[model samples]
Target chain A: MTLKKATAYRLSDNSKALLIFYFVIFAVMLSFILRTTLFTSSNYGTLGGLDASSMIFIFVVSLIFAESFKMLQQNGCSRKTIFLSFVYSTIILAVVMAVVDSLTAMLMDIITSNYESGFFQIYQARYQSMRSAQHFFEGLLWYVTAYVMMGAIGFFITNLYYRMGKLLKVLVSVGVPVFFVIILPILSNLTGGAIYEGIKNFFDFAWGFSHGFNPYFSMVSASIFSVILGGLAFLLIRRAVPKQ
Target chain B: MKGIEIRNLSKSYGEVVALKDINLKFGGDKIYGLLGRNGAGKTTLLNIISNRLFPDSGEVLVDGETAIENDSAQRKIYMMGESNFYPEGMTIRQAFRWSQRFYPSFDRNLALSLVEKFSLGLDKKMKSLSTGYNSIFKAIVALATKVPYTLLDEPVLGLDANHRDLLYKSLLESYQEHPRTIVISTHLIDEVANIIEDIVIIDQGEILRNQSSEEMLKQGYTVYGTAAAIDNYIADKEVIGFDNLGGLKTAYILGEVDNIIPPELEVTKLNLQKLFVVLTNRRALK
Candidate 1:
């Protein structure tokens, strides 16, 4: 019952407005892009497109976390219930968004079937390489994982801001980038670039392990990152007090 | 067994102690007036009980179950804190609907009736209401949520004289109809003196007095007469405070009243407001 209440609260008026705004903007922009690419002679075969829906999904999920946590907590909801409800709502939102994205792509393919549009051709090639069902399901899974990761990160950052004192907040704001941008360079210079080399090597290994390797491994890594961020968010919010 | 039991609850913000080793129990189907000066941990205690702020030292139990993360225990309580917790841009009707979702026992009819009584617009967004109406909205919700225990922190913060009276009457009506425990924290002591059956006085993060209103009233009295007569009458008694205008004077005495009073002196019961002022002032002097 608490979960249900929390979920209902999260999907309140502001969230609904955000969802509508994103969908309307995506649909209008997609139509404009398709019309120009199909009708204009020069841009017909060289059609370029970006996954704008995915970007909107990430932003929508982030805004939901940024606004809902404190409001729900203030309304006498337990932190555990709020976190669990967020998980459930995020899963539902992810599936809905992914399905919409896939349907839009399929519709675009059908509209530009006569012309060999670059964007539609790329999707068709993927559909042929992997069965259409596998392609659509894999795309959905990727979106779901990516959205969850983004949402969890957003929640963690918002919780951190709430939990930090004024002095600590200032320190974090100034210290983090200064450490990497200024202190790291000086340390690298003094130590014959060993620190820089170590950092680069670590990033190289991470990139290769996640993106350059099997797609399944990258999905697992995204899931792991999401869980870690979710755990951190829970810890920060478990005992947080609202500002006076 | 059905009331909220708070055990050794303590909370602090850095060096400032908000609540210190506080142990309090709010039980039974009676109205309680939780009186405290500003910064006396009244709101802090309510927030802790509602799980909006975690206690540093101890636990809160509702009917023998922990209330921290327990939904069953939390559902029995509805706290209308001083802060605005309703979502922005939500109308009063929408708020009522969502409140019903969270608290199944919330009485929509009662809330709507209160809106009519208070002359609050159901279509007005929460953020658009005046301060007094904001408080009225929350108070209406508190009165309508027929939970076992309701904790109200500064429920009448910005209400005027007439609205405050109406709210008090509505509060009494609700309590009489559905006999639930209601704890109210407010500075308007005299206004609620007749309404609250029990009184809990907290000062400087400590429980100074906790007793029935009648019993608390018995602890103090006042004598009015000429300055000389008043001084003479209070010569042998523990006087908490005094007021003087020209030659006339009033002395607030803290203890039993004598059966035989001087014929020239006038005696009256010390009102709750004066008693609160005297007690808190005496503590400050110490």
Candidate 2:
């Protein structure tokens, strides 16, 4: 009962922001269609890769920790309940948003000949070779896991920062992106591309780019990634106390 | 056994200990005053009972169920803490609505009545409320929750006298209507002394006294006299505390008052506030 109510609260609390976000996305799409029809001779496609945008949006949403934890605790929920409710609600959020993005992408595909998405940009050629037309179910399945993976990563980062002090938080926030963007690349150069190849090869297999463009493998790997992060986050949440 | 049982519950932050090997119980269906000085572990204990904090040792049991991370046990308890735990953007009406969702037994009509009585705006967000109204808002929801065990920490932190009186009266009326366990931790002892049925006094993380309020009061008395005689009179008694005003003096003694008062000296009941001050005061430890 607690899990149900808390998850319901988590979803409803975030529904307004998500509604506004979709409103903006559709409004932009409307303006594009209207502009080309009214003012221009040719229809120029609006390439809004909504799946990636949804991933980023869910990531930011997962970063909401302090206030949600406080609210759940005030509502007489235990830490375990809070953790379960969050993971469950985010999974639901990721899946529902994936459905919206997939349908919207298909809708755009039907409306404009020039319309394209990031998913198509990555796998359209491969999918075309494998099948006749765009696969709705396959795209949705992959997007669900991908978005959940994004949410899990965001939750892990939020919990990691919550456990750190002021100085550590600053150092880590600056150091992590710096390490990934600059230091890791420099290290790869020093290692004669072994590190880069290892990463590329791993993703190729994990994302099933090496396995005949099989999306099932990618879904499995994404689920595993999400589980790993969510499990680690549960450890942090277990002993987490509400701080002022 | 059917109440909140704390066994060897201790918690610390680095070198500072908030609670120290505290073992106590708040029995069912009574108003309890959890008295303590500032930094005296009252809030920490309440937080632990409500699963808001993790104790370094021991555990809290609610009706024989562990409270730490136990949803059922936690659901039976609610702590209206000094700090706001509800989200900042939530309006009073939204909070009340959510409270109903969280606690099925929540009294919606009572909450609405409280809102009108307090003259609080239903649409005002928590951040927009004045300090007094903020306390009032929190108090209203807590009173409406109707949980089995309710811990109120500084329930009237910023209320005016009239508001405080109204809250107390409303609280008593509520209790009369629906009896349940109420543990109130507050600095305002005198205001709550009359209404509280039981007293649990904590001093520096230790349980100083735990008993019925009426019985606890009967164990102590305060005597007023001139300096010379009072000084002589208190030497043989258990002088928990004393005060001096030039040549006149007052002594707080802990024991039965079997004998009649001396002709030169006067005696009165030691109210909860004065008793707490002397009992927790460092000098009174001797």
Go through the candidates in order and give each one's C-alpha lDDT.
0.78, 0.87
Per-residue lDDT tens digits for candidate 1, residues B1-286, read 7789989989897898988888888999999999999999998888888887878888999998988877788889898889777766778988888788878888999999999999999999988998899999999988999899999898898999999999999999999999999999999998889999999999888888989999998998889999999988898998878899999999988888899999999988877888898889889899
Stretches of candidate 1 exceeding 4 Å from the true structure: A13-15, A37-53, A63-67, A113-131, A175-214, B224-232, B243-250, B262-266
Docking class of 1: medium
Worst 10 residues of 2 chain A by lDDT: A125-134
DockQ for candidate 2, please give it.
Answer: 0.80
Off by over 4 Å in 2: A43-46, A128-134, B223-253, B262-267, B282-286
Model 2 CAPRI rating: medium
TM-score of chain A of 1: 0.75
lDDT of 2 by residue, B1-286 (tens): 6999999999998999988999999977999999999998999999999888899999899999899888898888878999998888999989988999999999999999988998999999999988899899988988999999989999999999999999999889888899999999999999999889999998778898999998888878889999888987777898777789999999888887738677889888876787788777753466
For model 2, how does the per-residue alpha-carbon lDDT over A1-244 read when each residue is reduced to its tens digit? 9889999999988899899989988887777766765577674756657667888899999999999999999988887889999989998998898888888888777666455666766667566521234567788888999988998999998998898899999999899999999999999999999999999999999988898778888899999999999999999888888888
Q: State the TM-score for model 2.
A: 0.93
